[model samples]
Target: MTSSGFEALLEAVRGPASVNVLVITGAGISLASGIPTFRGTDPGAVWSNEVMEKGTHAFFQRAPHESWKMYLQRFELARAAKPNAAHRALVAWEAWQEAQGRGFAVVTQNVDSLHEDAGSRQLVKVHGSLRLARCSAQGCELGAPRGTVPMASVDFSAFHASPSPETVPRCPRCDSRLRPHVLWFDENYTEHDTYEIERTLILARQSRVIVFVGTSFSVGVTELVYRRGRKLDARMFSIDPSNASLDRGIEPVTARAEEALPELVRVLQS
Candidate 1:
């Protein structure tokens, strides 16, 4: 996108009439922060066949300790990484929009809580979060409110190298094995209301402007947002280096999100 087009987007967002802004984010937004993308055939792709098999609900149910070990390693990476410029820029934009009496919401596909760490208040994590863990038992009291334990507290060392069912961490409330609170590959979005996919869809339907940052638009939720935005005649913008095959109305800013977003925020603030 051109500088003038970006300026126009900023102006539209900054307008006085309470514009509703929707920011959709994916794994690419966190790449600059040293997080790897899960899919694609690139050297950086983190999702191998083994990784995909291990990330499923079936695998977790069959081998709880092994699942925990895999996720603990992944969560450790997210814990060590900090939010990048793109994340900070979105936080600033959200603050500015709120100050202007506009509505703003973030719908993120990323499991990493970088957006929350960067101070994005109005946000939803559709894929769930790696920061939390809950009991695996169905009838346990810990299942209702879903008491989440911090990943830091869990001693993953015991399960390292080789994991068995006996090595898995047990829930304090029911002695059932604990699992990562993230949505698994075998789970359907419609089956679980806990991840707040409905809330994201509502935001997509209401948004006047939708910004898709660092996404490949491969997932169902991202495609849902795209279709909804097109139907609502919402102004769409994409920040990506690759030529993402997006629909016509989307203004493509052919740059990395970390590069494009900071400039976009600067213009919005100015």
Candidate 2:
């Protein structure tokens, strides 16, 4: 389809009539805001296997302090970063859709919490969020509430060279070590019983329009969502500079999210 044709399609979805829409976003959406993809070529930082290992459940169990240090660095980066045009566009689009009585939800793989910061009310962070922390001891009551810690309060520099459990943040309710409230490498989403995964699947089946942004479908959850959406006959589109081929029906808009999403919002508004 031509560019104008695609815009026309988006315009149709943006009509006053209610429509179910699912938006899936990835790390690529935050690239303009200086967040690194960390996967594939052109990674912002060279994360050795050792560093990657630190993001696993087993690693966190074995070395809570070390794991916290690595995650704190990432949290600091995300905390310092600001939302870019794509994030803001989504916020506006969600509001506009809500105004029209449409069902709009965002299912994002990013843990940065940028979507939340951008004022997206109907959002699901599939990979959990870096802004929150929970007790490592599952039995602790603090795990139920999901503690929030300001990155500024933690001394990231202290744990740079060595693991310091004493300096590591702890749960307020129970003094147990606090772990980043993220889905670790070894953890299964289905087993965790989180609402994000279940809700994404439900939305994928019900959505009339599904938009994939800044993701290459390298991860299983994203790939599953795309395939399920296709099986359910949801109209699919992608916005990415890589031009990654996700499936048969996906209409590709070959550009970065920052460049493409704002224009998409504008076209929809028009």
Candidate 3:
């Protein structure tokens, strides 16, 4: 927990009394909360790798009912999960930084609301949120941030295995099938959100140091955060259980994010 490396990195940035944005990605941070990463092997999934690769687009085209059921099944899983220690650490860091006339802008590739649930401010959810659903109909009357009757206040009971032959849910607004608002395999990201995320990365680059937590840094969106930090000559610290392909020439703290982040916050607070 006593990382002299993080201590030195903190000393370099704590002197500046301004917002210090921290860019992060999905994998390691959410593990403590029970969310699995791409390579992660959870007990088992309602949908397998094959189903996911086929995705909503393919399923809806060939088997509409099946796709809708899969979407609902995933939604229920996410709803049941709670925020974890790594998420709380980020929120605490932001609070402490704010007290010191500084702030944090967190841009994450996570679809889950763990960061928001952890009380982080100045957030950018680049991949959208799992809690939200929208009409699948293109340019349909249904819009962003879609709302619906509360699904029984989602809880532990909802994590049951998905029933076979997926059933589709409908949008009350337009009677169109409802779908998760998250980005999919064959889809492009939202331009507005992408621009805002890039803007935060630019700020993190100019920062004295950039801290990466739990991310593999394989995806372009997450990789850019580290790349920008390097461009600005910012000190870099990466926290993950294992080193990534992107770990070359960077200091790697080979530990889980849950273990590392709270410790980092404690040292940084001093």
**What's the lDDT for all of these models?**
0.80, 0.75, 0.64
lDDT of 2 by residue, 1-270 (tens): 246435744764764474778899987898888877756345573243364687788998787787886777787789899999999999988887887778889999888978988888999888877876766776676563333444445444545655676766666677777777788778767533443587888988888888888887766677888889878877788877777554467877777788777877786677
Model 2's lDDT to the true fold?
A: 0.75
Among all windows of ten consecutive residues in candidate 2, which has the lowest summed lDDT? 144-153
Q: TM-score per candidate, in order?
A: 0.89, 0.85, 0.78
- What candidate 3 gets wrong by more than 4 Å, as runs, is 3-5, 41-48, 144-167, 191-208, 244-249
Model 1 misplacement above 4 A:
1-8, 11-16, 40-42, 144-147, 190-194
Q: Could you give the candidate ranking by TM-score, starting with the highest?
A: 1, 2, 3
Candidate 3: TM-score? 0.78
lDDT of 3 by residue, 103-171 (tens): 566778777778888788778777666676566776565544334223333321223354332345566
lDDT of 1 at 66: 72
Model 1 residue 156 CA deviation (Å) reads 3.4
User: Of models 2 and 3, which has the larger lDDT?
Assistant: 2
- List ranges where model 2 is wrong by over 4 Å: 1-18, 43-52, 144-162, 190-195
Ranking by lDDT: 1, 2, 3
Better of 1 and 2 by TM-score: 1
> lDDT, candidate 1, residue 1?
43
